[model samples]
Structure formats: structure tokens, C-alpha cells
Target chain A: MSGIFNSSIGRKFAMALSALFLMFFLLQHFAINILSVFSPDAFNEASHFMGTFWAVQYILQPILIFGVIFHFVMGFILELKNNKARQISYAKNNGSANSSWMSRNMIWSGLAILAFMVLHFIDFWIPEMNTKYVLGDMSGMHNGEFRYFHELVEKFHSPIRVGAYVIAFVFLALHLLHGFSSAFQSIGANNKYTKSLQGFAKIYAIGIPLGFIFIALYHHLTGH
Target chain B: MNLTLKIWRQKNASDKGKMVDYQISDVSPDMSFLEMLDVLNDQIITKGEEPVAFDHDCREGICGMCSLYINGEAHGPDRGVTTCQLHMRKFKDGDTIYIEPFRAKAFPVIKDLVVDRSAFDRIQHAGGFISVNTSGNTQDANAIPIAKEAADTAMDAATCIGCGACVATCKNSSAMLFVGAKVSQYALLPQGQVEATDRVLNMVKQMDEEGFGNCTNTGACEVECPKGISLENIARMNSEYLKASLKG
Candidate 1:
């Protein structure tokens, strides 16, 4: 079973599986974040439960960390091998005929997403962990408002941060546009349903990232 | 027609190759692409110069012998045809065409416009066959009642001539399409059921040993394949591989 990771298709299969898992977590996190825009009390209630829950802390967080690390490390390794496969360059090469540019340049968007992920962790995840394990829940509390919601709104108050978030979401959208359906195709899920899968993936690729950007811009413009 | 050709030139596999330009005149539009090259070779020979060497046989296009990346497109600008079937009519007067060998880490240039494709043979030898008892007992082909769809798909996969154009056209030089076609063709047939597990596992392992890159789902192989092999075959191969791996 360990040999599976060494094969080309097998490596791609793992990449797709991890990507889909991360996407699921992203949607869950997005849903949680949107709650703050609606009501602070509701946001804090969910955040408190998420932070203190045993299953969420012990199992889910560790798996999420592994998934993220595997995705990044394997992605870079595969890109390196791909680069080594074609050493000499084509002088008059043309690319528009068969593949999308986004499919060809995944590493660029992926790197940008990695950069944003660090900041995202710093802004939310680290503080959540601190409150849950070491620091008390009152670390950043203000005026009886939820610390998580307050921290999120405060983070977006900086236009520079909001702008970076919006740009990272754009890169996320570009990465997902090719990554979504291609992940399914990579794992051999093709059939009559694949066309519909592609359609749904397109909507997902656009919608989720745009939703994130809207949330950031909404906070920046309207001071949510 | 008059054309300028920049053709890759090399003495042997170890020799460095460079594009050498040549002028050819009086080319007929009716000539096949190889025939146009034949005229150029004759001109070079008459001038007491070494003729450019390229791989080709069965100029009708089925043999998959002709391998060239012309004008940056594998097998020239035409779709679903090998270089032998490409006509000069697609090119125009005063055209400057670039001709080179297929580039891939697994495919080293053997000489001017010729690369060693024996890596494909090694990959095929790794699995591309079914195990059948040849001692006294033989099964009739008519005895196996295969569905029409399965038979058609097997034929579609069997059409790949192993020309290496897919490798040439691919950005990563991935041989997944070629390996996928071979694996799916056998997997689709009842006779292949006996060795399906080992066939996929060995062929895929051999493909990796050949140093081919990973498939990025670019769909370029299906586009440039002379046989018009479908990308769906790749998906089928992946399904077959996964099933086999899980069984282990």
C-alpha cells in the first residue's frame, strides 16, 4: 500500500482526495464565518462549541493539519518532477489549443494560497487554540462580544489585510477552477455524470471563492 | 511551392543537435508531407551534403512510424493524422517550418529527427498481454459473447499505433494516455480477465520506471493522438488500477 504513493496515478489520487477534504473543511469554515455577519451571539455559540468540543479538537484538527501538509508537500514534489520531465524548451510552442492556462499554472495559484493560509492561521486558528488550551477564553474579549467574531471583524478592518484576502481569494478561485473537476477526473470518476460534475465544479470554483472575497470586502466597505 | 525548413541535425544520440535550415523549391501541393521531405533529402544529397534523417514507414499513416514535431505541433497542424498523412497543401508559399524530434526525458534523440522509442516497448513488455493456455486446449473467439459497447471500446483503444505523438504534444511528457489505452483495451476484453490485475499493476509500474511525468488532465493527448484516442480511456485505466490496488 505504501508503494501506491510512488506511482504517478496513485500520487495524483492522493492529491485529489486531500484537496476534496480541504474543500469540505473550507465550506464548513465559511459557513461558520458567515454566522458572525448575521448575529454575534450565534457566532460565539458555534465558535465556543467548536473550540471546546473533544472530537473537533483531538481528531479533526490533527487530520486537517496532516491533509494540509501532505497537499502542499506532494504538490511541490510533483511539480518538480514535471519540470524535470521536460528539460529542453520548444521554441515555437503554443498552448491555447488543448489546455486552459489555469490548469497549466496551478503551482502559482497554489503558492499564493499557501501564503494566505499562514496569515489565516495566524488571524484565527492560533488564537482559537490559545483560548481553548492555554490562554483563557477571555484573552481578547471586549464589551461582552464574542472574541472570535471580534477578532475576525478587527482583522478585516485593515484595508491592506482585506485587499490581500480578496486577492488570495481570486487566486483560490483560479486554483479551484481547474482543480475541482480535474481532481475527480484524475481519480477516474469519468462517466456521463462527469459533464454535470464539471458544471457543478465550475459553479463551486466561482461561488466559494467569490463568497470569501465578498465577506472580506463587505467588512472593509460597510464595517461589518 | 518554395519553403524554408529548419530541421534538427545531429550525428548520433551522444551528439548535440541543432536546427539546420534548408531551401526547397518546386514542391507540389499534392505531395504528402513525407514526400516533400523526400524532395528536400534528394536536393541535399545532390548538393553532396548529409541528408536529414527522420523516422517513417507505411506513409499512409497507420504504422505510426513517422514521428516529428512540425511547427511546434506534433505531427504538424493537421488533426487526427500522422505526419505521413499530412499534405503539403496545409503549408503555404514562403513558409518557414520548424521540424524537430519528439522531446521527452524518456525519449533520447538517437540522431537527426529520430529518438529512441524502445522505452515504450519495455513498458509494453511489462504487461500488455493476456495469459492463455496454448497447450492442446484453445478457446474460440466466437465463444465469448462480448457486448457491442465493450468490443467497440477495445477496438478504439487497440487503434493506438504507439507513435509517441501524445508524448511529444504533452507538456510533461506523460505516457499515461498510451499506457491507459493498452491497459483499458485488455481490461475490456473477457480473455484479458485472467491477468487484468497483474497487467495493470505491472504496466503502470513499468511506465513509472520509464520516467514519464504525471498526467495533469490537460487533454492534449486526446487532441494530438493520430488515432484520436479518447481521454476516457485514461479514466478507465485509473479505475482498473484502483480496483486492483484495493484488492491487494
Candidate 2:
């Protein structure tokens, strides 16, 4: 295991696997958020179902949290390790202006995303869980089920809250644009197909985040 | 043509360096880049001022001794040519050029523009040679019957003159492209395979020990390389390093 970490391929494999897992998680999260655009009631009900799913809450949530932590930690470690290995200085101006801005700003973008994630969880998940379980707010629902769903929509209706969501989604899109293509190359997947994959990744990165942004912006614009 | 030059001047490795400016006029456009510098030195000589010290031998690009950072670009503005091969025509009349020594922790500046790139020699010493004895009696050149593709690739890799341009152009100051080329040259040949694993591991270790930065695979080195060495060599080396680490 130590040898695996020591090897170049091993480090690359670790980066690729972690990035792929994160990409999958992004897709799932995006799908759930997109539901709000179509029907807020359905999205809230789904969110309530997800919160109450005992198997997912107990088993999968822990693993998902571990995956995110591992990905972030490993990325920092790899960048530092790479910094240590260099010897000579480039005599020319560094980094072409033509290169993708996301690639150049990956570390900063990732940091932004990480900060946003903390804010996002605090804004939605924690409050919803606290109101449901701790305070026992079962007042405004069809059944005695979680009314935390309706509360999520009401939170998004505020201009400041909607603005924060839009900002967070922008950072997420920036992170994914670089991370997606880089993950593939790190895994030794360079080919003609890699170019196409990069294009697709860029589109998905923009589209998914925009999907979430639309939900927040739409709610802020429309009353219900 | 008259021009102002700012050249880095350092007496020794421990000496603190500073850029000293000089003005030269009536420079011939046909003069090679080094010749123009020589002309400037001659003017400084008549005034009893110390000449700007720099490295050069065999003014041809092959020797790799004439390392320079001209106007923030390695080996000046020309692509696929060394500083020695660069001509005054590349510059216009009355232009100001900022020249400096190749700055890196590994390659310590010996004087104005010369650095002790013997670190690269040390890396080569670690594992860059074949163990086969060569007396007056040796196998015929064609005995191995190397495939043309392999032979071409080996030749391409062998073209790396150890100029340190790749290191200078890299963001992390990584020597991966240079080390990769050397490793690939040997790894692709039958004469080089018997000790391939040991060669790569030892070379890579020496490169790291020299305090070179890691490769980010940005391909800047390829763009600025005097010989246009491909980043594919780095990829090849990555593969070799993987195999060696796994096997060992």
C-alpha cells in the first residue's frame, strides 16, 4: 500500500478514482436539485424522503462524507508533493493566457467550492434536520412527516439566500470544468476521445450548476 | 543598431547578483547573438570596465554550454535554437533586452549567465550508462536489427542536449522532460534494457534529490525546447517509473 502511494501511477490512480466518485456525486446532487425547477412540491417531498431514508442516512451518508474529505485532502497532498519535486525555474513567462482559466485557478476554485459546501449544508441540511428532529416542528405538513421541505423553498425565496446559491453554483461549475478533464488525463486516458470528453465535461459542468442556479433564481422570481 | 542591455552579474556562487545595464551602438544585424555580446564586451574592455561574463564554447547550438535567459525567454525569442544560434536580427534598433542567469535552486549561478548544470551530469552519472564493455572487439552495429520506429524514437530522445530549457520553461521547474528523454533513449533500445529499471529509478531519484520541481504536464517545456522534445517522453517515463516501482 505504501509502495502504491509512492509510485506515480498509484498517485494518479488515487486522484482519478476520487475525482470520478465526486463526479458521480455531483450528477446525483444535480438531479435532485433540478427537481425543484419542475415542481417545488415534488422536490421538497423528495428531499424529505431522502432525509428520512434510514438506510441512506445510516450507511451511505458516512461513505459520501468520507469520499468528499478524501478527495479534498488527497488533492492538496498531491499538489504539495509535486511542488517538492521540481528543481529548475522557467526562464519565460509562466502559463499561457490561452489556457483554460479553470485549469490555472483549480486550487483557488476548489477552495471556493469547499467554503460554499460548508455554507450550503448550514443553510439547508442542518437547519432542516434541527427543525425536524430537535425542535420537533411537525406543524405544516400533509401528514406528520417532515415539513422541512417547505422550509427549504421559503429559505430560497429570499434574495440574499438565492444570491448565495448562485455564487456557490458558479464556483462548483468552475471546479468541475478543470477537475473533469484533468481526472481523465491523470488516469492515462489521453487520446482523441479525451478532447471530446473535455468538451462534454465543460458543457456538463456549466449545465448542471446552471440547473441548480435556475431553481434558486426561479423561486426568488415567482412567489410559490 | 544601438541597444541597452541589462545583464546579470555575479562573481561566484555565494555572491549576491544584480543586473548591470550597458549601452552598445552600431551592432551588425548579421552578427550572432553571442557575437553581439562579444562586441559589447570589447567596448567595456576599452573603458577598463570588467566585461559581462557568460559561458560559450563551440558557438554552435550542440554544445549546450551557452545557456541564457534573454528578455525573459529561455534561449531568446527564437524557437528550436540555442542562444548561440540566435542572431541580432531577432532584435530591432534601440531595443532594451533584459538578460539574466538561468535561475533555479538546482542550477546555481556560477557567474553572470553561466550556471553549474553539472547537476544534470550527476543525474546522468547515477544511471545513464550501459554496463557493456567496449574494447577494440565489440558486436557489429547492425547485430541487434532494431526496428526503424524504435530506432527513430531512440534518436529523437537522444537529441536532448541537456540544455536545461525544459526546466527553465516548466512552471514547477520540473526536469521531467529532460530526464524522461534520457530515460526513453535508453529504455527503447536493446542495449539499454538490461538495466532499465535501475536506470530510471536511480535517475529519477537523483533528479528529485537535486531539488527539481514535479511535472504538472503543462507542455510549456515542449513549446520552448530547443530541440522540440515532446511531452510524450515524460509520459513514457511515467509509464517506465510505474513499471519499475511495481516490479521492485
Candidate 3:
């Protein structure tokens, strides 16, 4: 495993696997969040269901947390190794004029996304989980349902909190645009299939985050 | 046609470089870009000032040595030719052109528009060769039948003049195109298979060690390349590097 980490191919494979895992997690998270647009009552009920589920809280959440941590740590470590390798004879001319901005800024963008994730978990996930699990307070009623529906709506009412969510979603989109296609290429998926994958990844990269942002904006604008 | 030139001037690598203005009146519109520079140099010598120094071994478009960053574009405004082949007719009279040497952390200006490109040569020396020996009575050259498509691609990859245009146009100063060409040239040929893994790994290692930036696949190098080298070579190199990494 150490040898694989040291090798160029090993690092790429690690990146691909981690990226795919993260993408799956993103889809799951997006699906749950999208429910807010249809009905806050339904969303809170769904959130309550998820918050109370023993399997998700005990088994899947830990695995998801591990995946996120592993992906972040490995991405940084690989980038550092590549940077160290390129530091020799630093006076050579950079003759490549045709690379992209996003490709070069991956590390910085990744750091931004990582910081956003920490804030995100603390802002919502912790409170949602804690109120349901620890305090056992699932208050408020809307449309004949006893759920934390009011709390969910009340949180987005704050302009500062909504702005933070919007900003973090932007960073997430930027990360996904580059990360999606890069992951596929790293895994030797460079063919006709690769083009469609890149296109789909690009759409998802924009669509999912925008979907989350719209929900926050819609709630804030409607005075919910 | 007359044009004003703002060319970079420096005594040597140790001296500070700056842009110096020069005016040439009544220049012919048909003169090639280098020929216009030559006319300016002659006037500079008549005024007892040192002539501008730039690299241009082949007047034709083949030798990759004629590197010029003209008006913020590599090899001037033209799409698929070197500075030596760029015609003055592309510019109108009374135009102000800013000419500078290709600037990168790895490529230091030696004098005027000339930069020390020995770094590229050094990276090549790291492992840009096959390990075959030239013993007498070797196997027939035609013994191995390579596909026509592969042969054509190899020829295209072999066209890289090592001119550093890719670096000049790249936002990250990545040498992925040049390095890719070198790696693909060998990876496509059976003669290069015996030591393919070592060759790619060493070359990539040397490339990174030289302080060039990472490839972002922006396709700018392809646009600026005098020979019009494709980014497919880069994709090929990435694949080769990945495969080689797995073997170890």
C-alpha cells in the first residue's frame, strides 16, 4: 500500500476512487435536500426519519465521514508529493502555454471546499442530529405533522446563514467541475464514453449546487 | 510600411532586463517578421548600440529554436508558424508591438530575447532515449510491422521542436505538451517497449523536478504550437504514466 501511494499510478487510482465515493455522497445529500422545495413538512419529516434511523446514524454516517476524511487527506498528500518532485532545478522555463485555470487551482479550491464542509456540518447537521438524538425535542406542527419543520424554515430566514450556504455551494460547484472529469481520466476512461461522462459531470457539477442554492434563496425570498 | 518596436534588452543573464523602444521608417510590408527585426538590428548597429539577440537556427518553420512571445501570443498572431516565418504584412504601419522573451520561473532570460533553454535539454537527458545498443548485424528494421495509424501518430509526436511555446501559452507554465510528445513518440513504437516504463517515469520525474507547472488541459498549447501538436499526445502520456506506475 505504501509503495502504491509512492507510485504515480497508485496516487491516480486513489484519487479516482475517492472522487467517485464523494460524488455518490453528493447525489445522496442532494436528493435529501431537494425535498425542501416541494414541502417543508415533507422535508422535516424526511429529515426526522433520517435523523432517527439507527442504521444511518450508527453505521452509514461513520462510513460517510471516513470517506470524506480519507479523500481530503489523500488529495492533499498526493498534491504535496507531486509538488516536491517538481521543485528541482527551478530555473527551467515553463513552456506549456495551454493548460486550464481550474486544473491549476485544484488545491486552493479543494481547501475552500473542505473549510466549507466543516462549517456546513456544524451549522446544520450537528443541530439537526443533536436536537433529534440527544435532546429528543422534535417540536412544531405543520399540516398535521409533528416535525422540526419550523426550525428548518427558521434557519434559512437569517440572511447571514443563507449567504454562507450560497457561497459554499459555489465552491462545491467549482470543485466538482474539475474533479469529475479528472477522476474519469485518471482511471483510464478516456474514450467516447469519457466525453459524455465529462459532459454529464459538468451538468451535475452545476445543477446540484444550484439546486441547493435555489432552495435557500426561495425560502429566504418567500419569507418562510 | 513603418512600425514601432518595443523589444526587451539586457546585456546578459546577470543584468536587469527592460523593454527598449526602436523606430524603423519606410519598411517593406512584405518583409518577414525576422527580416524586419534584422533591419532594426542594422539600424541599431549604425547607431553604435548592440543588436538585439534572439534565437533562430532555421529560417524555415522546422527548427523549434525561434521562440518569440509577440504581443502576448507565442509565435506572434499567426496560428501555425514560427516567428521566422511570420510575415510583416500581418501588422499595419504605425503599429506598436511588444516583444518579450518567453518568461517562466524555469526559463531565465540570458540576454535580450534569448533565454537559457538548457533546462529542457537537461530534462531530456534525464531519460528521453531508448536503451538499444548499436551492435553489428542487428535485426531487420522491417522485422516489426507497426500499424500505419500508429506510425502516423509517432511521426506527429516527433514533430515537437522543443521550442517552449506550449509553456509560454500555458497559464500554469506546464510542459505537459512537450513532455507528452516525447513520451508518446516512444510509447507508440515497439523499439521503445523494452524500457517504456523507465523512460516515462524518469522523464516525468525530470519534468516535475525542472519546476514547470502542471498540465490543466486548457488546449492553449495546441493553438500556439508552431507545429500544431495535439493535446491527444498529453492524454496518451497521462495514460502511459498511469500504466507505468502500476507495473512498479
Query: Among these predicted structures, which one has the highest TM-score?
Result: 1
> Per-residue CA lDDT of candidate 3, range B105-180, in tens?
6777888989777778877887777775569767875898999988999889999999998877766567878988
The docking category that best describes candidate 1 is medium
- Candidate 3 CAPRI grade: incorrect
Task: Kindly report which residue stretches of model 2 are placed more than 4 angstroms away from their true locations once superposed.
Answer: A1-17, A39-67, A70-94, A97-104, A125-155, A158-179, A191-219, A222-224, B133-141, B145-147
lDDT at residue A189 of model 2 (Cα atoms): 58
Q: Candidate 3: lDDT of B11?
A: 95
Instruction: For candidate 1, write residues A1-224 as lDDT tens digits.
Output: 55887899899899999999998998898888778777877888888777778798789989999999999999999999987887776666666666788888899999999999999889888877777577666434567655767677888899889989989999999999999988888789988999899899999999999988887877778776
What's the lDDT for residue A202 in model 1? 90
Worst 10 residues of 3 chain A by lDDT: A85-94
Q: What lDDT tens digits, residue by residue, belong to model 3 across residues A1-224?
A: 22544445446667777789889878887787778778776777777677667797788888888888888898787666545433322222233333455665678878888887887788778876677668776553446765565666777898998898898888888888888887776665566577788889899999998998998898889876
True contacts kept of each: 0.67, 0.23, 0.13
TM-score of each: 0.95, 0.82, 0.81
Cα lDDT of model 2 by residue, B55-83, tens digit:
88988889888878888777888889999
Per-prediction DockQ:
0.69, 0.31, 0.23
- The DockQ score of candidate 1 comes to 0.69
lDDT of 1 at B83: 96
Query: In terms of lDDT, which candidate is strongest?
Result: 1
Tens-digit lDDT track of model 1 for B42-121:
98899998988999989988898899999988999899999999999999999999998999989899889888888899
